[model samples]
Target: MSLLAVSNLAKRYRRGGKPFAAVDDISFEIGPAETLALAGPSGSGKSTIAKLVLRLIEPDAGRIDFEGGDFLALSGAALRTRRARLQMVFQDPLAAFNPRATVARVLDDPLRIYNIASRAERPRRIAALLERVGLDTSLAARAIHEISGGQRQRVAIARAIATRPSLIVLDEAVSALDVSVRGQILELLLDLQRQERIAYLFISHDLGVIRAVAHRVVILDAGRIAESGDARAVIADPQSAVGKALVAATPKLVRTSQDAS
Candidate 1:
């Protein structure tokens, strides 16, 4: 069964005293352990779709079925419980987390909030989370702002997995990092997906990055799907005007291990 099913989803907004669709009649499905990427140019509603999927913002139309339940119909405690299986990683971890908060505190929030670990057991769990993300456990004592950008992003990833989510919405999750760090982060994501059977709704503008990680790619233009297919196939020979434009703007697609450094 599909881990996530979004059907005919739509979100509208007022622009210049006129209503416009930020996400228009979009539908897609993601399977367990799969990576589905949403790629589009700026103002193309990629982030808006990510927000809608995470329920940060409600859609004006259509349905969200997650794990075979009506995700849009959930409420109160039911919604909270269901949220444990849905998580997000933002483009900027510094903004996503309290810069003053320690790494341990950040990781502990999900464990405590979800009751995933007892107070007495949380320290060990936090350590394991850090280790799993390829970080030194001693960094737990450090404040989030004191860490490097790559370290901070890893911590963001660790926090996202703390809930043991079935699907993660990553909104430009690796775009801000340098090439080497970005490659590492992408590798970590792939490894985690392989290990835990987690699925990703990866939102990014970089087709090169999308090609490296995504199994399927959906190219959005002005809040609507313009084209979609196997990640490699669509990227290699884009059929839509917007898709072709995006490819032209990007650097040559070199088949590498995410161009790791």
Candidate 2:
């Protein structure tokens, strides 16, 4: 069975006082240690799907199952317990963190909340998490604003993996970074996935980034799925108009000299 399963999921909101569906009956699954990408233009409901899956907002209708458990049915402490296995990293890493807190405290919060470590043991765990995300132990003493964009993002990633979540919903996690930093972050994520066997629900509009990391791709357009399949296959030959546009918009790398006729 898939590690995460979503079926007929939907959410509606008022736009100009009329009900508008942000997510409309979308369904997909992410297997263990797999990366599934959600790609689309702005206003395509990609972020909404992530929020629904994370239960940041309640879905108007649908079912969400994680590890064979009824995800939508849980509440209060039960929901909190389930959430430990499902974490999220947002587009803005700085916004995800508390400016007042140092990196060590930020990483320690998850371990504390989940009771994964004692107060005395948390510092060691925090340092290990920093190292895991390719940061030095010295960074633990720095505040969110004091760090560079890449470092801040590394902190965000560290916090997400601190509890050793089985699945991480990365909502444009690397979008805010520059090209070089984005490439490094993607490589870090792939490495972590291989090491920890963690599955990813990676949402991004950048087709190139998605192609680099995701094993499968689901294209969303205007609150519904436009196309979905093996990443290389769909990207190579897009069947839908939206899919074709996304593929066309992706920045292609120049071919090597060996490919020249």
Screening candidate 2 with a backbone cut-off below 3 angstroms (N, C-alpha, C), the clashing residue pairs are none
Q: List clashing residue pairs in candidate 1.
A: none
Q: Return the TM-score for each candidate structure.
A: 0.96, 0.96
Scored by CA lDDT, what does every candidate get?
0.96, 0.92
RMSD to true structure for each model, in Å: 2.4, 1.8
Best by lDDT: 1
lDDT by residue (tens digit), candidate 1, 1-261: 899999999999999999999989999999999999999999899999998989999999999999999999999999999999999999999999999999999999999999999999999999999999999999999999999999999999999999999999999999899998999999999999999999999999999899999999999999999999999999999999999999999976577777544
Worst 10 residues of 1 by lDDT: 252-261
> For model 1, what is the error of residue 59's alpha carbon versus the real structure, in angstroms, after optimal superposition?
0.6
CA displacement after TM-score superposition, residue 147 of candidate 2 (Å): 0.7
